[model samples]
Target: MSVTAQTGQRDGTDRRAGADDGREAIARRLITGSVKRSYEPIVDLDWDSAPVPGRYFLPPGALSLVGTELWNQMTVEQRIELSRQEMANILSVGIWFENLLNRTLLARLMSADPAAAATHYALTEMGDECRHMVMFGRAIEWSGARPYRMVLADRIVMTLLPHVLRGSLLWVAALIGEEIFDALQREMLEDPELQPLISRLMQVHVAEEARHIGFARDGIMRRKPIRGRWETFVAGHGHALAGVMLRRLFTNPAMYRRAGLDGRATARSARANPHFQDAQVRGFASLAAFLEEAGLMSRVARYGWRRGGFLR
Candidate 1:
C-alpha cells in the first residue's frame, strides 16, 4: 500500500484529536458490555467431567501440526492427546501474555488521567485478564496437560518490544493476541467434536475479548496523529513480527514430544504446512483489516507482514 492510500483511511487526514470523545464513548460501552457478560470459569465450568474421551480439546483443524504428513500418521488417541497438550500450551502462553498485558496497562494507567473513562475501562480489562489467568491455570490442571514456557529468545523479544515500540506497536500487538485467539476460540466453541469443557472455556473468553479488541483498535486510531514517519515504520514492522511471534507461541515442540512424535521434525513439518499457513491467514484477516483501516499498514510494514505470513 502507498502512503497516499494509507492516509486515505477514514477520510485522508489525521483525525486523532477529534476521535477522543468517540473513543471514550466506545470505552464506556465496553465497560457496560463487560459488566453484563463477564464470566467466572471456576463457578461456571464442570470440574468433574473434564477430558471426556472421544472428543478433541481443540478443533482438529486449529492444530498447527494438523494436515501435515506427520499428523496423518497419528492414531485417533494420539491425535486427541496432542490436541490436549497443544491446547494446554496455548493457554499457558496466554497466561504469560496476559501478565505482560496487565503490567503494560497499569503502566499506561499511571500517566492517564484517573477521571477519564478510558482509564476506568483499562482497569476493567485488567480485572478480566486476572480472571482469565486463573481460568487457564485451572484448565491446565484439570486436563492433565503440563504448561509450556517461552523459549529464551521469545522471552527476550517480548520483554524488550514493549519498551522499544511503546505507543502504536504496543497496542496493536495486544489487539492481535486477543483477536487471533478469539477468532480460533469462536470456531472451537461451536465445534461439536470438541469437549464440552473446552467449549465452555472458549465461550467465556470470546465473550469478554470483543471489548478488549475494541479498546485496542480505538487506541491505535487515536495514536495515529502523533506518530511520525519513522515511528510508523517501526510500529508497522514491530506489529508484523509480533503477530508471527504469537503464532509461534501456540505451536510448541514440547507438545509433539509429549504426544510421542519426534519434536523437532514435527515442528518443522508444521512450519511448512500449507494448511497451517492458510489457517493463519484466515485467523489474522480481521487484524490486518483493522491495521489497514487505522492507517498503520505502510509499504515497508507490508513487507514484514508478508514475511511474517500475516499478509499476502
Candidate 2:
C-alpha cells in the first residue's frame, strides 16, 4: 500500500480507539455512581405502610380516560381507583421491559470483552433492573392492585419482532422503555397530591432510569450502523411496531373490570381520548426527537410514531 493510504488507515484506527476509550471512561463513572446511589428497594421503601386515602397513585392527567365524557361520569373514588390501577399497569410494563433488558444485557456480555468497563457496567445495570422489578411488584401489592397482563395482540407482536431487541434496535427499545415513562413520572413525582408511597416509588425508579437511559443512548450512538435500505427498513419498522405495542401493554383490560368499568368500552374510549393522545404526544416528544435526530427513525418509523401517538 502507498504510504499515504497507510497513514490514513492508521489515523482512522486511532480515532476509533479514542472513541472506545471515552466510552469506557463513561461506563467507569456510571459504575461508581451506581454503587454510591443504588437503593435496596425492599428496605428503602416502606413496604408495610398502607396507601394514603384520598390521594392519587398517579396524576389525573396521566390516566387514559382523563378528559373524556366517560371519565366525567365516574365517581371521584372510581377515578382514584382507576389511577391506582393504571400505576400498577405501568409497573407491570416496567417489570416486563426490565426483565427483557436483563436478558439482553446478559446476552450481550457473551460476545463482549469480559474485562471492559462497559461489560462491568452492564452487569451493574442488571442488578439495578432486578431491584426495579422487585420494587414494581411490591408497589403493585401496596396499591392492592393486581399485576396487569399484556393484551394478546401485543404479546403476539412481541413474539414476532425478535429484532427489536437485537442490534442497534436493542438500545432503541431500551430507550423507549425507560425514557418516556421516566419523563411522564417526573410530573408525577413533583405533584404533592401523589400518594406518599407512590412518591417514594417514583423517586427511586426515575433516579435509576436516568442512568439506564444514558447507557442505552451511549450504546445506540456508538453501535455499528445498519447497512442497506432493506436492513434499515426492517430495523425501523420492526422497532416502530414494537414501540407501539409496548405502549399498549401499559393498560391491562382487566384493570378496567376491577375498577368497575366495562373493559371493552373503556378501552375504546381511552384509545380515542384526546387527553390520552395528547399526553402521549407530549411525554414522548423528547424521546422521539432524539431517536429521529440520531438517524434511528425512518419514514415508516415516523408513520408508526404518529399512529402510536408518540409524534404529531
Candidate 3:
C-alpha cells in the first residue's frame, strides 16, 4: 500500500478520510478471521501451572472492600450465578477487543496511504488479543463454567455498533474498556483465592494492555474537534451515548441478578437507593482517581464523575 499523502489538504490537515474509517473496517475483517482460528486450552496451558507466589494482582490500597461487599451481599446461588457471568465477561474481553482490532486493521488497509507503523502495531495487538481470549477461555473452563449469554447492552455496543462508527471511536471506547480491565486485572492478580491460571492470564493481559492504552490515548488526542454547532451537538450526544454504554457495563443487570437480586430491580435500586449509592459513587470516584493518577483525566474530556455521582 502507498504511504504518500493525498492531494488537496494543507500540511497537518489530516486528509486521510479513511485512515480512521477504513482502518476500523480492515481491523474487523481481520478479527473475524482471527476468531475462526482456534487453539486448544488444555493442550497449550499446563493445567497445573503453579500460582505466582505472593500477591501480584491488586494495587496497594485498592478497594477490595467493594467487590467483597458486593459479592457477600448475594446469596450462595447468586454468587455462583454472578461468578459465572463475571467469568464470561472476563473471557469476552479479549474476544471483543480482538474484533475491534480487526475492524481497525480493515480501516487502515482501506486508507489511501496506510501508515506502516500503525499497521505493525495493529498486528501485534491482534496477537495479544488472541492470547488473551485463549487464556481467559481456559480460565473459565477450568472453573467448570461456560461463557454467559450476551446481554442486550453487550450485543449493542460490542456486537452491533462497531460496524457503524469509524475506527477512532473503537479506540476511544477501547481506552475506557481497557483501563477498566487494567484496574480489575491488577486487583485480581493479587487475590489469594484467585486461581493460578487466572492470575497468569491477567498478568499477560495487563502487559499487552499497557501498550493498547498508550495507543488509544494518542489516537483519541489526535482527532479533530467537532466544528459547527450541529457538529458540536452531535459530538455531545455521542459522548452521552458512550458514557451510557460504559455505565451499563459497570452496572450490568447480570451482575445484580447473579447476586440474588432481580436484575431490573437491582438496576433500579442502584439508581434510587441511597444506602447502595456508594457502589456507583465510589466506583466512579475510584475510576476518576485512577484517570487523574494516570494523567488521563484531561485527555478524554472530563469524565462525568463529579456532578452525576455515576457515569450515567
Candidate 4:
C-alpha cells in the first residue's frame, strides 16, 4: 500500500484489472448473505418474556467500570444496575448512528442506478438498519432505562459531516460506528451470563451488520481518494475524529446518576480506565489494519488515532 495506490483509485489512473466494478460483485455477495441469514428482530426475539433475575444487561467484562476502583467499591446489584443503564445507553447510540447511516444510504441512492447490484444491496442494508433502529428502540425501552438525546458533540458532528460525507468517507464513517460494536455484541452473545434477550438482540444485529460492514469496507477500498494532501488530511482526520465521537456517544453523563453513581466522577474514571481503553483498542484492531491497507491513514490522522485512544 503506497501513496499512488491510494490516490490512483479514482476512475482510471491504474488499478488491478476490474477496477471499475463499482462493487457489483461485493454487492451481489452481500445480497445473497442477506437473503440467507438476515434477521427480523421483532419476530426473532421473545420481547414479551420477563427479564432474567440477577442477569446482567451487558457482560461484566464489557462494563466501563470493570477494572476501576469504583467497580471494586460497588456491589453486584449496583454493577448490574449500571450495566442495565449502559446497555440502554449503547442502544441509544445505535439508534442515533443507524439513522445517520440510513439517511446517507438513501441520499446516495438518489443518484444510483436502481438496476445495479450495489444499489440493490444498499437498499437491503437500509432495510436492515431500519429494523435495527426499531429493535434498539424496543430494547432500550425494555432495559427500563430512559433514553436521552444525543450529546452536543454528536449533534454537531452529524450536522457538519452529512453535508460533505459521501463515497469513501461515508463508508469509513459507517465502519467506524459499526465494526467495534459488532465485535462487542459478538462477544456478548457468547457470554453465558448475559441476559437472554440482549444476547438474542446482539445475535440479530451482529448477523446483519456483517453484511453492512462488508459493503462499507468494499466501498472504501474502491473509492479511497488520497490524491491531494488536503483531501487525504480531511479523510484521515475525519475518520479518526468520528472514532473519537463514537467513544463519547457510548456514554451519557446522566446514566451514572440514574444508576446511582456520581455521574461526572464516574465518567472521568471511565475515560481514564486502562481496562476500557485496551478493550476498545482490541476491538478496533482489524478495522484499523484495513484502513491502513486502504491507505486511509494519513500521518497526522495516525496521530489522531493514538490520541483518540483507537490505535493504542
Candidate 5:
C-alpha cells in the first residue's frame, strides 16, 4: 500500500482498538453500576398520593420562566401553578432529548462491534431512558400539565439527529443535555420545600443520569485527539446549535398559557429577562468548561453560543 493508504489503515485500527479499550472501560463500569442499583419508577414513587396543590413543583430560581415582569405580577397561586407547568415542560424536554439520544445510540449500535463493551452500555442506557420517559410522562400526568411538544424547528432538526449525533461529537451533545437536566434535578433534590413526589422522581433520575454523564464524558475524552481542523470546526458549530436548541427547549409560550398568562407577551418578556439569561449562562458553565477542555470550543461556536444566550 502507498504511504497515505497505510496511514489511513493505521488510523482506523487505532480507533477500533481505542473504542474497545477506553470507551469499553467506561461502558463496563456504567453497566456494573446499573446492574447493582437500578429502580423502577412505578414501584419507587408513591403514585397513590397526588402532588400538593398550590405548592412549588420546582424551586423558584430554577424555573426558566421566572425572573420576568409577568412572573413578578402573578399571585402566589398562579406562581405555584406556573411552577408545576414549568416543571412539566422541563420533563417534556427531557423526553424529547431522551428519544433523540436513544435513536443516536441505536444507530451507533448498528455499526458497533458486538463484543465492544460500549455496545452493552449503550443498550443499558437505552433501557434507562425508556424508563425515564415513562417516569417523566407520569409526572406530567400527575401534575395535570400538558407535555410540551418540540417546536417545528426542533422537529426539523430531529430529522438529522441520527447522523449529526454520532462519532466524536456524539458525546458532546449528550453531555450538554444530560448536564443541564442534572443541574436542575440536583438543585431540586437539595431543596426540602419542593413537592415530595417531584423530589423523589428527580432523585432517581439524578442518580441514574450521573452514570450516563460519565460515559459521555469518557467517550468525548477518548475521541478528542482524533478530530482534525475541519472536523473540529464542524463539531464546534454542532455543539453551538445543540446549545441553542437546549435553551429554546427550556421555555415555551404554551407554558405561559398553562400559567394563565398571555402566551406571546410572557414569552417575549422571558426572552428579554436578564435574570433568565444569567440562569442560562450559569446552567451551561460546566458544559462550556468541558467543551473547552475537550478542544471542541472554537471561536465560531463561542459566537453561536453567546448569541443564542447560552453562554456569557
Candidate 6:
C-alpha cells in the first residue's frame, strides 16, 4: 500500500494509488494561480525610490537604546548607515518568516492524507508564502539596502533543521509574529507620513497576511490532536526562539554600528534598556496576558515561556 493509502485508510477514506483527489487538483490550480498573480514585484516596486515619510516608517514610542544614544552622538553619515541596517533587519526577518512558512506548508501537504481538504489549503498557503518572500526581498532591494546577514542561530534553523520540526515550530511562531506584524502594519497604513509606495505594499501584504494568520491557527488546531506532544515541544522552544528573534529586532549589532554606537555596547544596552522593558509591558506583556486569558498561555508556558526571556 502507498503512504497515502496507509494513512487515508485509517481515516476512513479510500485512496487511489499514485493519484490525487479532485480537491487536491483544484488546490494545486488555485495555488499556482495565486503564485502567478504575485510574481510581478520585480517590476512593480521601483528600486530607485526615496525615503518615504519618516513618521510612517518609525513606530511610535519605539526606540533602540543605541539608536537613541547614537542620535545624541552620531554624525549625519553615521545615522544614515544605522537606518540602513535597521531596514535590512526588517527585510531579513520578513523574508525568513516567508521562507519558513512555505517550507511548513510544503511539509503539511506532503504529510497529509491524500483525501484531506486541508492538503489543498496548505498548498495555497505555500503559494502565499512564496509571494511574500519575493515581495519583501524586492522591497529591500528597492530601498537600496543589502540583505541582512542571517544570525548564526537563524542560519542553522533555516538551513539545517528537519522539515517536520521546522514546520511545527514555525506554525506557532507565525501566530505570534503575524499578530505583531499586523498591529505594526495597521499603524503604518494609517500614518500620513507613509509614502505611497510603502503604504501600497503594506496594504497588499497585510490583506494576504490576515488570511495566513487564520490558516496558521486552523492548521495548528487540526494537527494538535495527532501531534500534541510534538506541538507542545515546539511551542516551548518557540518561546526562546521568539525572544531571540525579538531581541534581534530591537538590538541588532549591525544596526548599532551603522547608527554610530559601539555595536556590542549598544546591543547590551538595548537588551537591558528601559525602553524595551516598557515595550514588553505594553506590547508583549499585553499579548501574553491575552494568551493567558484565552487559556493558551499555560500550554505555551509549559513549552518554554519562562526560558524564552519574554515573560520574566
Q: What is the overall TM-score of model 5 with all chains considered together?
A: 0.92
Off by over 4 Å in 6: 1-48, 52-60, 66-69, 73-81, 113-116, 166-170, 222-238, 280-309
- What is the C-alpha local distance difference test score of candidate 4? 0.81
By lDDT, the candidates rank as 5, 4, 2, 1, 6, 3
Alpha carbon lDDT of each predicted model: 0.80, 0.81, 0.52, 0.81, 0.81, 0.59
User: Can you list the residue pairs that collide in candidate 1?
Assistant: none
Residue 15's lDDT within candidate 2 is 69
Report the error of model 3 at residue 59, Å: 12
Number of backbone clashes in candidate 6:
3
Estimated TM-score for each candidate:
0.89, 0.91, 0.62, 0.90, 0.92, 0.71
Please, what are the lDDT tens digits per residue for candidate 5 over residues 16-61?
A: 6876587767788899999998889999998889788666888887
lDDT of 3 by residue, 170-190 (tens): 554566557756765665575
Clashing pairs in 6: 82-258, 236-303, 236-304
The superposed Cα distance between candidate 6 and the true structure at residue 106, in angstroms, equals 1.7
For model 2, the local distance difference test gives 0.81
Per-candidate count of clashing residue pairs (backbone under 3 Å): 0, 0, 23, 0, 0, 3
How well does candidate 1 score on lDDT at residue 132? 95
